[model samples]
Target: MSDIAAEFDFSMRSHGIALEMQQSNYLNNRICRPLVSAQATLVLESANADLLWDQLRRVAYVPGCSKRLAGTNWPDPQVVADELSAFISQAEVYYRAGEETSGPSAALQYYYSLLNLAKAELLLWRPDAIINQKLTHGVSAVHATGNFEDWRVKPQRGGVFPLLYEKRMGVPSSHLPGEINPDQLFSRCLESGMEYIQVRGKTLQAVPLYQTIVTDGTYSWSHLLIEGYGVIQQNKPSWDLVREIFEELPPLHHGNPWQVFALSSRLSLDSFALLIPCDGKYVRSGDGIHIGNLRLPEWEEELAARLRPMLGHPHGYFDGTLTVSLSDSEFVGLTSDLARYLSVYLVSSLIRYRPSALDLRLNPDQAWYLAAFTRQAALPALQSAANEILDNEFVFLDRVRG
Candidate 1:
């Protein structure tokens, strides 16, 4: 875990420079001063992680910026204390919801616990850094709020909306990408979804994070979803894949077919396009679909079918027993497992973390933004940090496959 923290620290330093967070020599001096000294201080204090994470669930709007842990010269420690208080206060809504899921947003309830935990960990370390606007934008902003795991929503592609979802009861769709058109598969899955989105970027790493979900002016439920196809392929996740899965969903009956949401991602600009390609000829406004993707039968089915069976070995992958059992506890374990994977991937991308390399200047505001900005820029290294923990397990899985 210390290794993970150290790597993330380096990642932020490298990224902070790249993003111009340390543009001034004064800022550079301030930011670089803390690295080695703060390492141990930052890593050992792990208490009530969930209590803090619960705050992010309250976020309603996309933030304009983000924070990272890159700066050396610590800003007002007093401000950090105040933000910590706010982070805890806001997270309470989700904590209370977790204790009782009576609201219409059961999906949100499920994610509330995990989102809080993530924030709590970060806030415990740097309260003020989480809110730095220069560090990130939109959904990234939401996560720092300590309100919801805003990281879960599929990234919007260039100002588009996507259909995000809650788990619904439906057989998994079997005829997805391997045989079916990937676009059609996505469309069919979201047919009955409540949240639709349009996006800009192309691909994203599949790691659960806080997401803000709203349509028009009304609030919609925010929950976790897969971000990268690579993650799905790697995990071989089980989801509903039944055809006509959307038939059971009730229409929103309020917003237009083009209602915009708060946490939706722009089209994927990354090398990987995590979502279906936008329909050009059918496209009028370059709209996004925000319908729920989590429980949509089409999505489950398509993903299931698209990810071919782990074959070439034996029928043991699916024996005649015909019964599958997975506990909430198991999923919790999976969530942790997946998070570590993503963190490691992010961490590995960091090559170096010196202020001189950053090549930027920082003012007060810029210093705060450095917290999240550099950390995100260093995601690949953090992701690698997470993966380092899994090397053994992956080898074991490969042996099983063999």
Candidate 2:
């Protein structure tokens, strides 16, 4: 076995005794239950941008809150707070202005809003990182032939884009391409799924994952139930396809594979269940899990992260279900937040610098897609960023009430 896998096995075995002890205590107490759900309901329904702004403001003004949230002490906490507050406030202004405008002008405002928001997020994540240094857009338009498919943007070495990419993915910007095309950006967006099908004639597959408990009378374990597998490829069960979907999942940690095993028998003709083993009997509080071990919440978050390449809101509106998509193409490591940001950046650039090209290409069909993108894309990006910034999952409650 490979060193990593061998080490993982050894660690699992070493924990077996403690796990058994905890399981015994858990059963004797009969109090183990699923922990508090990650989903938070916004009491006052507002725009996601507004919600994010409120959260960011708290990080800025609330003493010691930034350190608590970032998990690190800032050399100059006040400076970081001031910068965060400024950037967030500017972003809110742009977002509000974008909401009041329409057409390419709205796109321009929204792009700037997202850019500022990204900078603020960077500040929160890396309090000591330089933001005032000379930085380019980090991405540039390479081709714009008045066709969305032909439009392309290239990532530069040193810019806010690369910095964001590095911080989020733990990889250098050089790992990305010199240029990215529109189809790549659009195909990754869940909001653009229908548009992708209509334009590219290929369906994007996404399945909701239900969290539940499974047991064999002696031991109970957490499992994620995925239904509608048949819908992926028109009722044909392909193990290769299933593997592909799971392969997209990120590791629970740097060296450990997902502490999840597929119950092969549970793989029926249409659905499947993945067994997600806890480090010990599930505990209500975070204290029970070892700092080095992957916790249940982290497992769920990692699973959700795997779906990052397929851009869109990760949760269902009413049910708050987590959904994962099966890509028809290879993984490009283009997360929804980054892809959406870059896509809008590309559009705004065209509006600002190459208005004639955009005007010439703005046919009825292209305009329809552009309108759809402008309307639906920003929310998901904001929601995703808010989740990262606040270190929690938030579901706006307004839609359910409406």
What shift in Å separates residue 262 of candidate 1 from its native position after superposition?
48
- Which residue pairs in model 2 clash with each other? none
lDDT (0 to 1) per candidate: 0.22, 0.53
TM-score on alpha carbons, each prediction = 0.22, 0.67
Number of backbone-clashing residue pairs for each candidate, in the order shown: 134, 0
Model 1 agreement with the true structure over 1-402: per-residue lDDT tens digits: 122112222212211122322223212111101101111121222223242232232221223111322221246644544454454444456445534543122223323322333343344344444545223211111122211121122222211000010000112211111121112111111111112122211222122211112211111221112223233333223222111111111112212111111122343323221122111011112122222211123322333233222100001111000011122122111112222222221211111222221222422332222222322222221221111211110110111210
* Deviation in Å, model 1, residue 32 alpha carbon: 39
For candidate 2, the TM-score is 0.67
lDDT of 2: 0.53
In lDDT terms, how accurate is model 1?
A: 0.22
> Which structure among the candidates has the greatest lDDT?
2
After superposition, candidate 1 runs with Cα above 4 Å error: 1-73, 109-129, 132-153, 156-402
